[model samples]
Target: MKIMIDAGHGPDTPGKRVPDDSMREYEFNSSTARRVVAALNDYKDVQVEITFEDTRDVPLKERTNKANAWEADLFVSIHANAVGDYWDDNVGGIETYVYLYPGTVAPKLAAIIQSKLIAYTGLRDRGVKQEDFHVLRETVMPAILCECGFMSNHHEADLLKADSYRQKSADAIVDGIAEFYGLSKDSPDLVPGNGNQTIDKGWWRKAMNLTIEQWRELAAELNRMYQDSVSGKIIPPVLNDYRWVEKAYKTEMTPEELLTVMSIIQMRRIV
Candidate 1:
């Protein structure tokens, strides 16, 4: 998938710094964006485009236009939120924004991102909201604007200045996107090729949305089906068609199991 990432504003953007001017918002945004891109680089067939490579300001129009011209599958703009010019300990939380459209995929994506961010960072969830932000309104694909935290908040500003916190935030964002795309870290393609590795909870959590009991039952059923197919009791479905399998059985098999089944089916077709 092609993803366009925008680090909001420029290094010299006025009124974007902490009250003490310790760190700039662009510094935080750019670093987080770079980390996110690095994390996604581990995946195969993922094409990431960054709107700004340097500390220079890129116009909002230019950023959206580049994403549209590239036909990106998704657009993510990252920024730090602020309520006033100075610091306030009371106003700190994470929020995600989508264009005010009922049927678009942006809301769902925004929800997933917001949840993951809160889960990973232990940040307060301000929830997903609809807005007429320029990036959200202009982006061709599903778009989300993530306000990472309150830069005007004293505690959050300090956290934003730290590299570890930035990395953690980036991780949450990428993991959320991976879940949206049904990309499991358990897939051999993501992590090391270990047969004993259990399926990543991401697939089960996002795609299945099943209760614990339901997941257990479905997993048993998938194992039975795989065994049956291998023992010649029944023919396996189309192996080369991942999309079909994904659509047909949304949560039946884990990603690793799906990969194994598809590989076997494809090999059988060739043989």
Candidate 2:
């Protein structure tokens, strides 16, 4: 499945940022998009594309239009939350948001995202919420704006700043997306660099971040399950990274590649 990733605001917006002024919502959103995009690439059956890239200020309407244009399966806008109504020195938690809709998929997605975010980061769960935000209210598909962690809170602000946390947060979102919808992980087109014939045949088109791996040769560090699977050697551990091939997408995976990708995903054991 193809999904649209929108970083809430541009770099120069002077938008939401941490209290100490170190991090901004744009930074957090963009970085999480990148991490999620990178992490999801293993499935080979999914494809992810950012609505707008590099300094391009895609308006809220334009972002939704892009998703509509692509008929994207889901629309995810990432952001960091503010501290409080009065700016007290304390406050922190994870909140997943959707527009006001009764018994809609948005709320379900929000709840799953909220739970996974809490589980992955050990952050406080503010719970799923409904708000009439422009992006949330206007998007046609299942749309959710994740205020991943509170930039206002001292501990969460610092914690959200870490790449490890950001990566894990992105992974949690991807996993939630996969489970919520009955999307498949099969990718019949993924090629193992079999040659130009395989490349021209175009089996790897769905993946956004799919690329030739760095260490083409199997390393000893690779799990026995993957080595065994390649030759009926052993059963692979789910989401072991070394066992999974990164697909470069954030939406959903095809059925054919699902089990293989899960075996290769290193972070599968995370959440």
Candidate 3:
């Protein structure tokens, strides 16, 4: 079967950047496309056709046109996630999207890719979602978009730079495709030039590591504290202790201290 691998965004889109300003989304997405193509190429039974060879000049519509013309069995658009203004690149994680009301295999294909991305990347699973995407909506086959990690997040930006991640990312994409189309080891649909199609049993272990509900609770609590401090609604014990307030950065100073002592120290003079 033929597969169209579209590395989303073209040469026109410089795409997003990292905190250290080291990694670019265009570079990451393009590199991932290459890795995916190579892996699929290894399977002679599959013909991996890439739509975005030179992202610098490739137009989004043109890429979609290529996929439609190819009559591919599936189309996977690889991309990284980015949010907010350039000054604060913070929100990120893997969110694989399928067209809002896609064809029969759209949901199934997205599920296959989304599960594998979290399993191998060790990143937060943003879950499989629906987006009114132009490419996925117009494409003739099952499609998915992978937002690998957040470019705004400082820690994840560092992780994306590692060389090993590229290979693993490619493996995840390839393995997922193989599994989705009933192309298991016994299937003749398996990629050619391989004796056995290895399954990643370790996926379960990685999946058990991250849970979104836990983080959501943590964020909720943090916001609640900030709100309480603003409204003077916090516990009196914490507010009364000058040192504790300072530790939490909620209050100004020790009430017991004389005005003379407080006036003596200027805001500029104090750390």
How do the residues 121-177 of candidate 3 rate in per-residue lDDT, one tens digit apiece?
Answer: 888888999888888888877888878877777766665665456556767888888
Task: Report the lDDT tens digits of candidate 2 across residue range 90-128.
Answer: 677778888866656878877887788889888778898
Clash statistics: count for each candidate:
0, 28, 6
| RMSD each, Å | 15.1, 9.6, 21.5
RMSD, candidate 2, Å = 9.6
Q: List TM-scores for all candidates, in order.
A: 0.68, 0.67, 0.64
Give stretches of model 2 more than 4 Å off.
Answer: 84-89, 184-271
Per-candidate Cα lDDT values, in order, are: 0.73, 0.64, 0.61
lDDT of 1: 0.73
Candidate 3: deviation at residue 233, Å? 60
Cα deviation in Å at residue 52, candidate 1? 1.3
